[model samples]
Target: MELKAISDDEKQRYKTVVLKFLEDLSYNLDDKAIINYINKLKKEFAPKTARMHIIRIRAFLKFIDHPIANLIELPKVPKRRRRLVIKVEHVRDLLREIDEKLSGPYRLKLKSAVLLSATSGLRAEELYKLRLEDIDLENRTIFVRAEIAKDYEDRVTFFSKEAQDVLEEYLNTFKPSNPLFSKKSLLHQFSKLDTRLRMKHMRKFFSQQSDRLGMPTAVKKILMGHSTAGDVDLSHYDFQDEEELKKIYDEYWKNFRILG
Candidate 1:
């Protein structure tokens, strides 16, 4: 079977998860064994992590054409409490506080990243995976390659002019050819700050900004790279003209902007 469809990282994760699960049993591959394994995982791991393990197992079983693959069922992952989104008025103030505390290249990197995340709604993983070529400063757009995307599908997203300006300055200074932000760099920079003020909160900022600005739900979902799989109508809506999406982005981009 073609297990090479997933990335090396994901494959390694599959290995680790499967091994841990197998160790819990006597290497059984029956539905009862699998369900029992999931029960064990529910106690040991977070609901989301446990759900992911079940998904991986299901995929693997299907790929190998195991008999029980069709019979396995996964439990719903419990909903997590929403994180507090950064308010619109506090946007510039938070950026200013972080910028003032740090200096030189570190300051530029974190500030630029936060601006991009706030404006574009790209996840930290997606932002870190960005390469210099992925950005189009003149057009105010960023192309997220499928491999780096969480959905395993390629899509385009946009940034505000304010974010574009900061990004341009950053590109001019760093002149990056590979990934724009290293995992270590993002982790180190975010670790120093309060949890409420961390890089992850920028996504919440983008969500709230979209609501406050009244961006169309369709446009907002596209910009955020959210999958419209179950929404029968939205899947078709997603296929409409890219230029129209860009127009909406351009029209509403400034509504999320931070003060200089």
Candidate 2:
């Protein structure tokens, strides 16, 4: 049952075949004969969308105890990557595409949400889950607890000057302590407005600004609260020097640049 213990042949004959079987089952049994088809639906879509379907099918196979039920090959699909850092100019185009004709609270909410996620690297879920207390205006940082971050690691996110300005406006003027975007779902509501703002797009927007600002990759990763790539364990040291994290976080904010 451990992955390392499974022989290559067993993986091929059992795991690979099991995956194909589940795909065939989901596809063939679909009521419309194309109802649950991923390939049919994903011509221009990211492969990860299709991969999610595969994951659902895998979960179903496990639940049902089908052939090769205990084994599954990891499906090869494109990952939904975060955006590379760029400047505000690139995001300006996207903002134009949005309901630019609209202004005031709705506009502020949209811009603030997008900018915070882009600059601070908050996940869409984290944005939704963020509390008023999470943002420290005096410190110009956003703290994500272990429960909210993608990884279990805790990190404080720094904000750009413009981001701080907009957030301050949002915090001081409207929806002071409420959810930044109070809808059940941002994309869902935007769907009605004919503007679907996805997490991927938000990251892409962030990356463009970050890239333009000439942010270092390491800083980007750190701001995003991702675990570093190398074998070095900064977490261990941070654990011992918990107070140091706040210092580092504040230092990072001290150098942050905002866009016009």
User: Which one wins on TM-score?
Assistant: 1
Candidate 1, 57-77: lDDT as tens digits? 777778779887787777678
Please give each candidate's TM-score: 0.70, 0.62
Off by over 4 Å in 2: 1-55, 68-87, 95-99, 183-185, 192-199, 205-214, 233-259
Candidate 2 per-residue lDDT, tens place, 163-216, comes to 678778877777655566654645643554444445556666555555555555
The Cα local distance difference test for each model comes to 0.79, 0.60
Query: What does candidate 1 score on TM?
Result: 0.70
Q: Clash totals for all models, in order? A: 0, 11
Error of 1 at 208 (Å): 2.1
